[model samples]
Target: MKIIQKHELNSLKRSVDQGTEEQREAVKKIIHDVKQRGDAAVQSYTKQFDRVDLEELRVSEDEMDAAYESIDGEFIEILQEAEQNIRRFHERQRTNSWFEPAADGSILGQKITAIDAAGIYVPGGTAAYPSSVFMNVIPAQVAGVERIVMTTPPGKDGNVPEGVLVAAKLLGVHEVYKVGGAQAIAALAYGTESLQPVDKITGPGNVFVALAKREVFGDVDIDMIAGPSEIAVLADDSAKANEVAADLLSQAEHDARSSSVLVTTSRELAEKVEEQIETQLKDLPRYEIARASIDDYGAIIICEEMDEAIAVINEIAAEHLEIMTKDPFGDMAKVKHAGAIFLGPYSSEPVGDYFAGPNHVLPTSGTARFSSPLSVDDFTKKSSIISYSEQALKSNGGKISQFARLEGLEAHARAIETRKERWK
Candidate 1:
């Protein structure tokens, strides 16, 4: 890992991959075919990309049961426990409809309602994220989304990963499809013969999936166009170097473009962490991916003070920020931007990625500077409520008309005054 001064913090804001023009065209072609031909197009792409022939697009009860059987009982228990924790956390994020009555007997407030349907895409192949299933599904479920569906690619054996199916089954997300890539996104956005169109889509995928989501966004809401995983550790002399290196590698192993950075006040800690990372890379199964990520994107920023370290963290605004200082919470207070903050060594980034209650479907690629983690709010829509009594309208109708006229909206002015004229 390269060590740099605090002045180099701006260099960490990476330019997100928007995919090649060829890939974009390819995705557009896939979406168009899926929209036009529906099930046939989805099947064709499965054969082309996934190299699997699917008799049915949907997962069956028998397959789900078989998936359940494939996984051990202990892991099943673990899934259930994780679900409860996630549910408990997201339940707190649930917002209710409210109305406030005024002196004039007018009711003004907001109404919250979950979208009618939600579709979540889970990546298959080398990365089968059962944890992602838990994180994405549980929040929508907690928000009371009625129809929750999932999609994943099938293997050469014509089966989605057993863990994915098991996770979806635990959440009662039975409307899972065996389609992946841009075709699956098309199937979700535009109803196929088998799958009904959803109001919104969430979860992560490859460049094709991201582009497909971008194409279909106006038609249906999407979670986010997330970039590669990132982690920035704000540590001090009190922080242990080996533990910090492991945490940094956790994000590095996710992708070749993933970034793992350490912003510390201690140069000694930075030096030790660099050594530890090189040693740890030897043991990682995804050594090539991690090594490239660390070499190319990762860094160690040496700040002179705790305040300076905190400022660097805010400027970077990494997806996952770990405060590994003597006073982690105190440091967190000064920190302004981060998708998710993990305090101390125990609260590792993966802890949030997996069993931790907070959603792991967080803002990536410095989006935390302006955005937030995926929450129940993403699944739910809010509506403003205005119930004006006769007296209230009579008092405000003229002002409303004046306001409308100010904007040169005559139809809007008449819409309010006509009601007032009838009151007269």
Candidate 2:
């Protein structure tokens, strides 16, 4: 990993910005073709891109049943444990549609209701993220979403991952489609004959899928236009350098474009962490990917002071931020931006990625500056509820009419005037 001083803000945006125009246009064209040709276009793209031939686009219940038999009982039990934690966390976020009434006979509140359906995209070419299915679906399920549709590309042998199918069965996904890439997004955004459209779609994908979601934002709701995964570790003298190195390597292995940074006032600790990463990389399965990521996007910034490190972290607003200082809480209070903050040495990013109650589908790049981690609220809508009784309208009707007339809306003023006659 490259080591830099505290003065390199200008070169940062190059690392974290969204896709180029050419990439975005490619995604847009795919969406256009899917909109016009529907399922045939999706099938063609699946064959050309994934090199898979499929007779049916949706995964059948028999497939899910087969997956149950193929997967081990132990792994299925772990998925269930993760599901319980996720459900318990999101259940707290469930809210009632409430109305407040006054003695004057006025009513006001918000009606909280879940969306009709939700679409979840699971990447399938290189990796299968069954954990993603649990993370994305459980929150919508807790919010009382009626139809939860899932999409993932099938393998070259025309089979979805056993773990992915097992997760769908565990969550009772309304449907599973054997489609992936930007076309899957387009299919979800604009329904075809076989697959039904959904109110909102949530999950992480590659640059193509991210651009597809960006293109179809107005057509349907997306969780966020995610970028590559990222991790920023703020460690000091108290932190164990080996643990910090392991935590950084975890995110680095995600992709060649992934970023991992270490900021510390302890020069000794920074160098130790760097050395440990080099030693640990040799044993990792995805060491090549992690090495390039660390070389291209990773950094160790040795700051003269803790305040300076905090400033740099806020500027980056990484997807995952870990504080391993003496007083982690005190340091966290000063933090202004981060999709999720992990405190102490054991609270690594992967914990949040898998078994932790929080959703792992977070804002990537520097989007944590404005975006938020996925939550149950993402699947629900709020409508303002208001009512007024005759007596209440009579007491306040004159002011309402006057304000409407002042705004030159005579129709609004007349409506209030006509109601006032009944009270008089």
lDDT of each: 0.92, 0.89
Compute each candidate's TM-score over C-alphas.
0.98, 0.96
Backbone Cα, N, C clashes tallied per candidate: 0, 0
lDDT of 1 by residue, 1-424 (tens): 9997767766666756799999999999999999999999999999999988888999999999999998999999999999888889999998889989999999999999899999999998687789989999999998889999999989899998999999999988899899999999999999999999999999999889999999999999999998999999999999899999999999999999999999999999999999999999998999999999999899999988998888889989989999999999888999899999999879988888888799999899888989999999999999999889999889888899999999999999999988866665
Q: Which residue pairs overlap in candidate 2's backbone?
A: none
lDDT of 2 by residue, 1-424 (tens): 7788667744444344468999888888999999899889999998998898776899988889999999989998899999998889888988889999999989989999999999999988678899999989999998989999999988888889999999999988849999999999999999988888998989988888888888889989989877788899998999998999999999989988888999998989988998999999999999899998888888999888889899999988999999999989999999999999999988988999889898888887788889898999999999999898887888888899999999999999999899756755
The best candidate by TM-score is 1
The TM-score measured for candidate 2 stands at 0.96
